[model samples]
Every structure is written in structure tokens, then in C-alpha cells.
Target: MDFSLSSEQREIQDLAYKFAKNEMIPVAHEYDEQGKFPTEIFKKAWELGLLNTCIPAEYGGSGFSAVDGVLICEALAYGCMGMNSSFMANDLALLPIVIGGNDAQKKKFLTPFTEEFKIASFCLTEPGNGSDAGGIKTTIKDGGDHWIINGEKMWITNAGYANLFVVYGTIDVNLKHKGISAIVVDPKSPGIEVGKKEDKMGHRASDTRGVRFNNVKVAKENMLGKPGEGWAIAMATLDHSRPLVASSALGGSQHALDLSIKYSKERNQFGVAIAKHQAVQFMIAEMGMKVACARLLVHKAAWMCDQGERNTEIASYAKAFASDSCMQITTDAVQIYGGYGYSREYPVEKLMRDAKLLQIYEGTSQIQRLVMARELLK
Candidate 1:
């Protein structure tokens, strides 16, 4: 099989890389240190069509394919995963709409962001449920022309910064998975509260918080797909996004390896550069090999989805393996730096901290395993 990127894909990746290097790299450390939300940079990125990309061209978006989206994600993430994730918050928010929203719903909600920089958030995880969608306790009740929603969402990215949210909750608990429903909520609506921002372990620049709906009213027309289709919509959304998450992890891993290799060559030990040491050389080699494999899987998964193929299994595998590689590579980069690695004076420690959320956010490594097992067993 051919493994080269098409000219269009290469252009997308190079443009994204240049944009990230020029814009995000300068502010990555400051944002991480201050845990500040880089709103201005986000707006700049939006102007470049870097945010909310999944929205179709008919809705004023650039109309990028899944492969293009993943390529952009990887390029941005290579500069800094935290910044890339903050920018990618738009994709997580809009993927469900692109995958399942009716034409009217898409036009109303997805079109506005393409005109200017605006962040959107996806609300799925609740206080009690992280990976289990069926455990969602949020409820939406029919109210004639509207629906009254009551529940809380935790660990939501871009919560405070997002103007729109794609929210999931239950309409009928007795129906279990079929009882779930997805709706779009205006973050500014009355009774819709954006909780305090989380002081996370990493990805500090990405605004994450709890969102509460206390009988918030949503137009019935904003319901995504049909009632009882929330679970399916959520799963389908992940089928598209897991590859991007894998790309994020792979980017962090690549940066870690690069940093380590450069340091190993320049730092001398026993009157010779540490690069001559067999152990350090072996570690760098393993990291490079894993990063390459993960990058390929990430691209393959996105390409499969763009081709309209069933890639549930491949997506899970890519995310699981790539995220694991991120964790491992960052850890090894720290080892290569020894004392300096564990300190804030060097970038590896920050990379290690940033790499961690990659495993937890989109789906835990264990959850990915479950997805893979289910698909394989079937």
C-alpha cells in the first residue's frame, strides 16, 4: 500500500506546522505556566480555519476531509499539544453536528463559527460517568416548542470559552442506551451555568470546567439527530475524533524524542557526547520507531473514515497505541535528561505532564482496550 501523503495533505500539514510554530510555540510555555486561556491566539487560529473545521462548506466552513483534519491536528500538536487541544476544542464540539445534525440544525449552530473565531464545547462526561455514556444522569424533558434540561457536565473543554455546546443526557432512563438524547445548548442561556475552570495537571491553556443546566430551555429544533440516538451519535463522533487524539499524542511523542536526541548529542558524558552511549541511543531509537508507527496508524485511521469505511476497530487501536506511546516516550525523554528532565527548567517535564491527559481525556487506555475487544470479538 502507498504510504506517502498526497500533495494537498502535505500542503495542509506544512501550513499548519508553520502556523503553529509562528503563533503557538512562542506562547506555549507562558500559557502553561499561568494556566491562562489564550483567547487572542484562538481567534487568530479561527481566522485561519484552524478551529471548528468539521463544519461543512455549506455551513461557511472550509469543508476539510477527516484526513485533512487529522493532518492539521498533528502539525499543530507538534508545536504544543496543549495549544493544539485548545484549538481543537472546536472539532470536538462540532464533530457530532457534522456527523449527525439535520441540515437546519447544522446551519443554525455550525455556520456562525466559520465567520469568525468562536469556541464550541462537547459535554458528555458527567460527575459519575467518565467513559460510560449510559451512566449519564442529565435529563431533558419535552416542553412544547422547547426542552428543559437539568444535569451537570464535568471536565468539559472550552466550557467557559465556548459559546455553543453539544450536550448529551437521558430522556428515558428505562430505555437505557436508547433513552439518551443529544441537544445543542447556548452557553449564555439563563440557568446554564459555566462553573469554575479546572486547575488541571496539564493542558493548562485549554479551558476546562463543569457545566450545569438548571432547567435550561433549549429549542426543540436543536436536538441533534433523533431522540434516543445520543449514544449512537456520541460513538460516531468518536470514530472520527479518536484519530485526531492519536495525532495529538503522536505529536507530543515526536517532540519529546526530538528534544531528547538534541540534548543527548550536545550534552557530554565521560568526555564524549551521551549520544555515543549505547543505552541512550537505544532509548532514542525505540522512541522514534514507536512515534513513526503511531503516526502512520493515526493517518490510516483518518484516511479510512474519510473513505466512508468502518474503522471502529482501527480508530480504537490507533488511539490506544499512540497514547501509550506518548506516555512512554515522554517518560524516556525525562530519563535521558536525568536530573534536568524532572525539573521545570527543561521542556521534557512539561511534555511528560502534557502527555498524560492524552491517555485520559478522549478515552482511557482501558476504555480503548474495551472498544478494541468488543469490535474484535464481534
Candidate 2:
């Protein structure tokens, strides 16, 4: 088993991290404070082929494997997870098409994204339920020439800014998962209402809103697979996306640890540098170990995905462990910074806020555990 990155992978990693450092880091705090999306940064990233890395090469994307995709996510996320959400959310929105759409569908829906910088939202979560995807209240019905959709989707990332939306709805509420369908819809359609952007606790720089669909018309050509296949497509997208989420968690954890280590060496306590103290050393030591272990899990999951293996169990492991570790590591980083970390004047506080959403989104940490349990029992 080779542990080292290929030279090309290293180059990708370096470029992403450098872009994050140079472009994202400077404005992350301001964007977070203002609760604004960093459109210019996203434009720069898209131009460099860093934003839409997952669309197939045939469609003009970088065609990076899952492992390659995670590497880019990790490095960019290291700069600012909030800003990184805009980048990562693009993959989330596009994955359903990549996973389930036919070649022609890909050409029509995904090709334009690779050619130009655009935003999209994965509309699965609803006002009724999030983790219970089958419980979504959104409804879709046949309209002969077009599919008519009516419902509300909550906590939709990139909703306010999205040019397109991959919507999930049930044809029959009684059928639950069996009745679900996935359709790509243009947000400009009549009866589509994009709510005001959400005031989120973290990832504030990412555009998240509630989108309401009132009999919105969708092209049949935009349907993903046959009807009633949306649930499977959504699950498959989540399974593929969880690894990138884990990698992003790894980025946040690594960033926090770096800050903690730097702060510890410079911070003085009781006549000595905090780095010289055993208590601080122990926290830093545990953080280092946690980051390393989480990275392995993330890479393992991404590697499995790249190998065409179904990784439901391992993806859960990575997502749960890495996101939980990120929350812990960022918290510890604040502890190390000792009061200043609580202030917006420091970066770790923002990281702490951002790390939180990692656990909550892309399947919550508790949901990840249940997934692992189900896989094991099965």
C-alpha cells in the first residue's frame, strides 16, 4: 500500500492550498462577519479548475478521482471551511448527475458548469426532516410535457446564488423512498421562490437559504434516471460526498492544530512558555494524533471510492471520526489560545464555528454512527 501522494497529487494539493492561502484567507473573516458569499474567490477558484473538480473530463471538468477531489478539498478547506463550502457544495450538487445521469443528461446539465463558474444546490433536506431523507415533504407530479414540483427545501447551501438546483421530491408520499425522484431545475422558473439567506452559526460565508417550489415546471430531459430512483441517487451522492466532508474536517483540524502549536510556543504562563508545560503539550500531542488518525480514515475512504468500491461503512467511519475530531480539535485550539480564542480577533474561533457544521451537515455525526451500526449489523 503506497502512502505517499503521486507527484501530480502533490501538485494539486500545493496549488489548492496556495490558492486558499493567497485568495481565501485574507477575506474569510470579513465574509464571515458580514455573512456574505465570496463570489470573487469562487470565480478565481473556478477559473483555476479547483471549484468543479469532479465533473468528468469529457464534460470539461478536471475529472479528478475521489481521492484527488478530497486532496483539493482538504487543502482549500484548510484556509477557511466557510469559503470552502461554496467549493464543496458544488460537488455535492453535481454528484447526483455524475452518479445517476446518462451521458446526454451530463452533457446538458453539467457541461455548462465546467465551462463557466456557476452555483447549484442539492435540494433534499426539507422543513420536515433532514437526516430522514425519505421523509421529505416535497412532492413531484407528472405534467405530461414537464414535471411539476411543489414543496419547500430548507438549509439549502448555495440556494440564494444557485443558477440550478437538483431537486428531490416524492411522486407519492405513501411510497416514501420508493416514490422519490430527482430532477434538475432552473431556478428562474416561475413559482420558484428563494428565501432570504439563513443566519447560520457557522459557514456564514456560504449562501444557505430556504427555497420554495410552487408547481415549478421541470424538463423531462433533466430527470436523473427513471422515476422513483431519486432516493438511491441521493444516498449514492451522500456516500460519495461524505469523504470530501471528512477531508474538509481534516483541514479544519489541521488548521486548528497548527494555530495551537504556534500559539503554545509563543504563549507564556507561570514564567514559562506554554509549550514547555506538560498540560499544553498533552493537548497538542492528542490533537496531533487525532489529526493523523482522521487523515488516514479520510484517505482510506477516498481511496476506496477511487477504486470503485462501495464504502458505506468506511465513509461513515471517516465522516463521523473526522468531523467529531475537528470539533474537538478546534475547541482545544480555543482552549490553548486561552480567552483570545473566544474573540473574533483570532482565526481559531471562526474555525471552531466552521468545524461545527462539518458534523451537522453531510449527515450528522450521530447519523453516521447509525449508518455504521446498520452496515455492521447487515
Candidate 3:
């Protein structure tokens, strides 16, 4: 198989890397400390066509391939995943439109954001259910000509900042997965309330909150696909998003290895550079290997998506393996620094914090394992 990137892909990667280093890196720490969203950075990204990379060209987007999406995500994540997530959440929010939205729905919801540069979000998790997603208790009751939604979504990324939301709720509680329905909601709707942003352990810069829908009236026309299609829609969205999550993890691991190697080369111990010590050399070597392997998985999944192949199994493998490797590599980076690694002054501590959410969100490491196994056995 040809693994080399096309010229277009290479150019996009270089642009993303340059933008992250020049624009994002300088402000990453400040935003992390303040737990604030960087509107200016997002606006710049939107201006650069970085924010709406996955939307179709006819819909006023760059129409980048899936591999291009992963490449851009990796570079942006190299600077900061918290900020990267704030940007990448657009991908999750727009997935339903790309996957199943009718032309009018796409034109009205997807096109405006791509052209006007507004943020979007996907709402799936609720306080009672995340990995057991089918347990979501959010309910949508039919009203004459409109659907009145009354439910609360928890840990919603981009909740406060998003202009549009692709939300899912159950239309019939007795039907289990078959009762689920997906719809688009405007944030300014009369009954929509976004709670205070949650104080998170990591990815603090990304907006997270509880969103309450209180008798919010949405036209039946806003519904995506047919009722009872939410499960299928949700799965399709994850198929595209999982690889992007893996790419973010891969970037964090790459940053950790780079920092560890640089420090080992310069730090002196027992009258010699730490890099000269076999133990230190071994640690870096192991971390490097993990990063390389994880990257391969990420790229392979992205390539599969570009080929128009259904990549559920490979996507699960990449997400599970890359997230686990990132956590290990970042932790090793901290261990290599001895006491200094634990200090907030060092970048490894930040890497450790950022690597954690990779395992928790998008689907936990355990959930990914289950998905991979189920697909493999079938």
C-alpha cells in the first residue's frame, strides 16, 4: 500500500503545524490556566478554513478527505487538545449532516456555519448514561406541528459557545434503541438553557456544560433521517470521529517523546548526559516505539475512511490503542523528569493531564475494546 501523503495532504499538514506552533502554542498555557475558550484563535481558524474542514465543498467547506481531517487534528493537537477539541467538536456536530441530513437540512444548518464561520456541537451523553448510551433518558414528546423537548444533556462539549446543536432523544421509551431520534436545535431557542461550564481535570480550555431543554419547540422538519434512526446515526458519527480522537492522542504522545528525548540529551547525571545512560535511553526508545505504532493505527483508519470503506473495527482499534499508549507515554515522560515532571512548570505534566481525557471521552478505552472485539468476532 502507498502510505505517502499526496501533495495536497502534505501542504495541509504543514499549514496546520505552522498554525499550531505560531498561533496556538503561545496561548495554550494561558487558556489552560484560565479554563477559557479562545474565541480569537477559533475565529482565525475559521478564516483559514480550518474550522469547517469536513463539510462538503458544495456546502461552502473545504471538503477535505478523512485523512486530511486526521492530519489537521494531529497538528492542532500537538499544540493543545483542549483547544483542538473546541475546534474539532465541529466535526462531531456536522457528522449527521454529512452522513444523513436531507439537502434542505444541510443547506439551512450546515451551509450557514461553513460560510458564516459559526461553531456547532453534537449532544449525545447524558448524566445517567455515556458509554451505555442507549440508556439516555432524554425524551421528545410530540406536539401538533412541533416537538417539545424536555431533557438534560451532561458533559456537553461546546455547549455554551455552539450556535447549532445536533441532539438525540428517545421518542418512545418502550422501543429501546428503535425509539431514538436525532434533531437539530438552535441554541437561542426559547427554552434552551446552558449551565455553567464544568470544572474539568483536563481539557479545561474546551467548553463543557449541562444543557437543559425545557419545552423547546422544534419543527418536525428539523428531524434528521427517520425516527428510530438515532442509534445508526450515532454509530456512523463515531466511525468518522474515532480516528480523529486517535490522531489527537497520537499527537500528545509525539510531544511527550520529543520533550523526554530533548531533556535526556541535555541533563547531566553522574558526570555524563542522561542520554548516555542505558536506562534513560531505554525509556525513550520504548515511548518512541509506542508513538510510532499508534500513529500507524491512526493513519490506517483514516486511510480506510478515505477509501469509502466501513472501518468500525479499525477505528475502534486505533482509538483504544492510541489512547492507552498516550497515557503510558506521557506518564513515562513525567517519570523521566523525576520530581520535576510532577511540577506544573514542566510540559509533561500538561501532557499527562491532556492524555487522560483521550481515554475517557469519544468512548472510553474499555468501550473501544468491546467494540473492536464484537466487530472482530462477527
Clashes in model 3: which pairs? none
List, residue by residue over 106-128, the lDDT tens digit for candidate 2: 99889999878899888889998
lDDT of 1 by residue, 1-378 (tens): 898889987888888889878988777888999999988878887777777768788999887888888888877887788877877878988988988898888888888888767788999999989988788899999988899999999999999988889999999878889989989999999998889989988898888999999999999888998899999998999999999999989888988998999999999999999999999999999999999999889989999998999888999989999999999999999999999999987888888999999999888999999999999898
Model 1 earns a TM-score of: 0.98
Provide the TM-score for each candidate, comma-separated: 0.98, 0.99, 0.98
Residue 184 miss distance in model 1 (angstroms): 0.5
**Which model is ahead, 1 or 2, in terms of TM-score?**
2
Instruction: Give every collision pair in model 2.
Output: none
Q: For residues 18-129, could you state the per-residue lDDT of candidate 3 as single tens digits?
A: 9989998888888998998988998898888777677888888788888899999988998888898889899899988788799998889888887686888899999888
**Overall lDDT per candidate, in order of appearance:** 0.89, 0.92, 0.89
**Candidate 2 least-lDDT 10 residues:** 45-54
Per-prediction CA RMSD (Å): 1.0, 0.8, 1.0
Alpha-carbon shift of residue 39 in model 2 (angstroms): 0.2
